[model samples]
Target chain A: MKYGYYPGCSLEYTAKPYDLSCREVFKALQIELEEIEDWNCCGATMYMSQDTLTAYSVSARNLSIAEHQGCGEVCAPCSSCYTILRKTNRYVKWDPHARAMINDALSAADLSYTGGLEVRHPLDILVNTIGLNRIVDRCVRSLEGYRIAPYYGCQIVRPVYHFDDMDNPTTMDRLFKALGAEVVEDYPGKVRCCGGMLMMTFEDVALDLNADLLEGAVTRGANCIATVCPMCQMNLESYQPQINAKRHSNYRVPIVYFTQLLGLALGIEPKKLGLDDLLRPLPKLAPAKPMEGVK
Target chain B: MGISQSVSPPLESELRSAFWDHVQMIPDGHKVKTCLQCGTCSGACPVSHAMDITPRGIVALFRAGMIEDILKSRTIWICASCYSCTVRCPAGIRVTDTLYALKRLAMEKKIYPDKFPVYALSKAFTRNIRKYGRNFELGLGFHYFLKTKPSKLMSNAKFGMGMMKRGRLATRPHKIKNLWEVRAIIERAEKIGGGK
Candidate 1:
């Protein structure tokens, strides 16, 4: 199957590993990813705060391009992008005022969105569309020793999206289990906020929020936290030293994109998956066991 | 002595009704009238402790016609936009969206907490998107620190350098080829009242 990919900004810079691993995993799974040409930012939460129509107009530009490309579905790796894009689609489809205004805005650029495109998160595509059994069938190694805390952060499953349970999402949990890893089911911070852009302007508050997420995972004996959002991975991973300094607690827990782990199970090399790009080093996992039916 | 009045007299009736009308204009803002005073929003908020006026308190203040006071509080900027409150609200109140509307109102009025630079970050982010069609992280940080707190640049230099060394920081901005298209969209949206 084929899909259009919107890496968003973070995936190009701070969350480059997420981009790398997601591409590598999809390739290994034989899913074609056709990138939308000349896509712009999704306007994230920042644009929405300043002007409603402008935010929708900006996000709709990408949808217009996707529809023009005949990409029936667009997959955004960043949770913020996924949420914003989907929100824009809903507004264009359901809100006539917004639809007319956005179309008017689009006309300035010679573009329009009639709303046939589906915006999806990579996690949903991997777990639901690809299915766990198919993923296991391709697995070459078992993640038996890794205790993973599946951190969903916010945005992806929120605002009442039916892709996963908004309150207690289990797609990542089940995906990890199917790969032979022990999932941390009691992780309370799974759907918690990772302080997002607040980490930049309000350091203290963001640090406290990240500290709680780290403490929750570490105290539960998790060696690493698996995440789907780029911002979550950046905040939870890169800010550990600061979190440790302020909280007076050492938190060496590695935060990684779930795709990196999935790639590893698929027998892709660590270098190919950008595992070396991680800010915190992952703990040594017990040697992989060969899949039961694999050579 | 007669019981002293603690609450201030409500705003002039005209101003009070105007403020209520503005609140109801937010997406699903009419739901504000249906708020149960349950405090579910505040309880679900991750950053509510840092907020001077909690989410639940914002709705209560709306009923009290104290939106001006709410605008001046740190609560609007402190919201991380996690949407926890929106998902968990039993009354189906879109709390986060309501806060976004308040932020827009505050921006329009040029009202914000004293010395707060949260708005600076958003300005820098949107500026970068407008210029490059995608966020230039390096440019965004430089602009943000300059506008908000120049001293932060020195302290954050180490972290910035680490990111650079890891190849996570792009030295050059990634500009889209069709820059005029994005500008046209923004310009047209602005001309059309920008959803006011």
Candidate 2:
């Protein structure tokens, strides 16, 4: 299947690993990712908080570009991008005032969104569109030794999106299990906030939130936390030292993109998957074992 | 306490009624009036402890005709926009979106708490998007630290350097090829009221 890719800004910088691994995984699965040309930022929560119409107009520009490219659905790997874009889509569809304002704004650049462009998260696309059965057929390496805490973060599931259970999302859990990894079933901080850009604004509060997530994963015997959001990965992984120092605890847990693990399961090289970019190294995965019941 | 007592009842009621009308301007904001006084939003909020007024308290204060107090409090800036409360609210109040509206209102009125980095960060972030059509993380950090707490820049320099060494931090901004289109959209939106 072909999809338009919107990496957003973070994927171009701090979340480059997510971009790399997502490309590799999609390639292995033969899902073509056509990037929308000259896609601007999604106007994340920052712009949304300041100006409503401008934020929607900015985000809608990307949708307009995707629609121009004949892409019916655009996949955003970042949760913030996914949420913001989806929110824009929802408002444009339901709120007439927003629709008129956004379209009028878009008309300035000779672009307009006529609706029907789907804004999707990579996780939703992989687990739902690709399906687990097809994924199992492609797995060349088992994650038998990996105990993964699937950190869903906040955006993808919340605000009553029908993608997955907001409180207890199991798409990642199910995907990890299908790859032969043991899922941390009772991970309390699975859907918790990773403080987003608050890490830059309010370091102490963000650190505390990340600390809670790490402490939850570590206590659940998770060797690493698999995440779907760039901000969550950065906040939870990059802030471990500060969290350790501030919270008076030791935490060396590797926070990785779920796509990276999926890429590994698909037999992609670790380097190609951007595994080396991780601040904390993922524990070595044991060699693939014989299939128990599968062909 | 002193401020409310100083206002005559007629003027206070007028301000309170205006506040209610303003709340209705928010997207799905009318649902806020349906809040059952349940603290579900506060209980669900991960960072409510850091908020000067909890999520539920914002609604309660609105009921108490204290919109100014809510705007000046750190509650709106402290919202992480996690939307936990929005989803969990029994009354289906869009608490997070209300917070966003409050943030915009606070910014418009310049009524936020002083020395709050969230304002600086948001301003820096939006400015970066406007200038480059994408976030320039290094520049964003430089502007944020310079604005809110210049002293923290020294402590953060090492962290920034580490990110740079890891190939995660881009020294230069990534400007989109069609930045003019983004600029046009913003300018047009501004002319069209920008939902202000």
Candidate 3:
């Protein structure tokens, strides 16, 4: 399963866990993440917001790098990075004027993108590469009893450009079901932003918005929420305590990365699975005392 | 909307003010001033039928501080964050970002909406980041579904079964090796306030 892996800036700095864990998981699944040489930023949605052309050009530069590596599909672990790259690719291919401008911008960096490569998210790669049956076959311990929420943050499916179904994308839900957990059916904010940009500028907007989402989950009877995007992860996990404090509520739902649960069900030790690194310590699913059925 | 839009207003009272304060940080944040209300964004919207306020109206609600209604309305959940409004808006307003800003503000109010499934979705994403450092759709999806009520799980059974048949979903435990490095990274994220 060797492929071009672009971990983006966040994974390298703030979201290193995503990059490192992705490598670890792929290794176990016999998938390989060959880094694209001399990769650069995906514009962080910043360049795009400032200058749309620069955004397209920056993304093209990254795509051009992947092309140089002779890879057909470049897998991006960050949703922001994935969306930015995908959006830029689609624009250049779909709009000749924009393509010309982006191409000209790229030439300033002495790079040329031929628009033959595909940019994909890590979740897309996992499902496409491992296949559902392989994931099912690997799940010795089934999440048969847990009611899980399949979360797809704003960037994954929204805007309906060069992606899956805009409203109801089943990719995340499909992947979760194969892993032995029952996927919750509610349509809670799958494509909604978690105030990613505001989190940087305004504290109240980010924390309060996240609290509302958390409160909704508590009412929905979701014990665990699963997500494929890191920004959503950080927003929900970090904001919970603040929600509890300011709102004076006990919404103690655990915010976990979908991969951590996969590693756990696969019998990976808690430490190895990165269980201790959360805002609120992850609570035990059951009493420490041995359960009737749990090993 | 297969996905819900924001309810009425698009910003909270205090946060609405802050959006402008932060708007200064953004190079072109003032683009909001150009809205002509041609009704193009609302008319073109697939989910406009579901919103109490048109996409254009939602913006008006923001400026008016009729934000509480917007924050509590079902429309916030309906938003797909499609950015179609932004893309197609002749006014070039950051309508999608404003919508997201509304969701963030609404969530802070601790408003619980059960009809939409996004609550679970957001929670699952949050939990995934906390534990795995990344997302595993198969694992997280199952974890999310299993965590829900029995009847809710049944409603999801159809989709669950489809994953089984397609072999696109996992039915087994999938663990990654060398996860210790990932653990350290997560710890750092929290210590550095990536998680509150």
Query: Which parts of model 2 are misplaced by more than 4 Å?
Result: A288-295, B1-25
Candidate 3: C-alpha RMSD to true structure equals: 15.1
Candidate achieving the largest DockQ: 2
Real contacts retained, model 2: 0.80
Against the true two-chain complex, what DockQ does each candidate achieve?
0.73, 0.76, 0.04
Report how far off residue A244 is in candidate 2 (Å): 1.0
Per-residue alpha-carbon lDDT of model 3 for A1-295, expressed as tens digits?
Answer: 3578888655553344455567666666777678876565565544333233444565577687788788888888778888878877777667676566556656555667777777887777777667776766655565655667777766777554445666567887776666656677774656555767444333455666677777666677777777777778767875666668888998777777677766655555566555664544455544222112331
A36-57, model 1: which lDDT tens digit per residue?
A: 8989999999998888788889
Candidate 3: stretches off by over 4 Å: A161-163, A283-295, B1-196
How do the predictions measure up, each by TM-score?
0.95, 0.95, 0.61
Between candidates 1 and 2, name the one with more favorable TM-score: 2
**Residue A38 CA displacement from its true place in model 2, Å:** 0.2
Q: Clashing residue pairs, candidate 2?
A: none
Clashing residue pairs in all predictions, respectively, total 0, 0, 75
Question: iRMS for all predictions?
Answer: 1.2, 1.2, 13.7
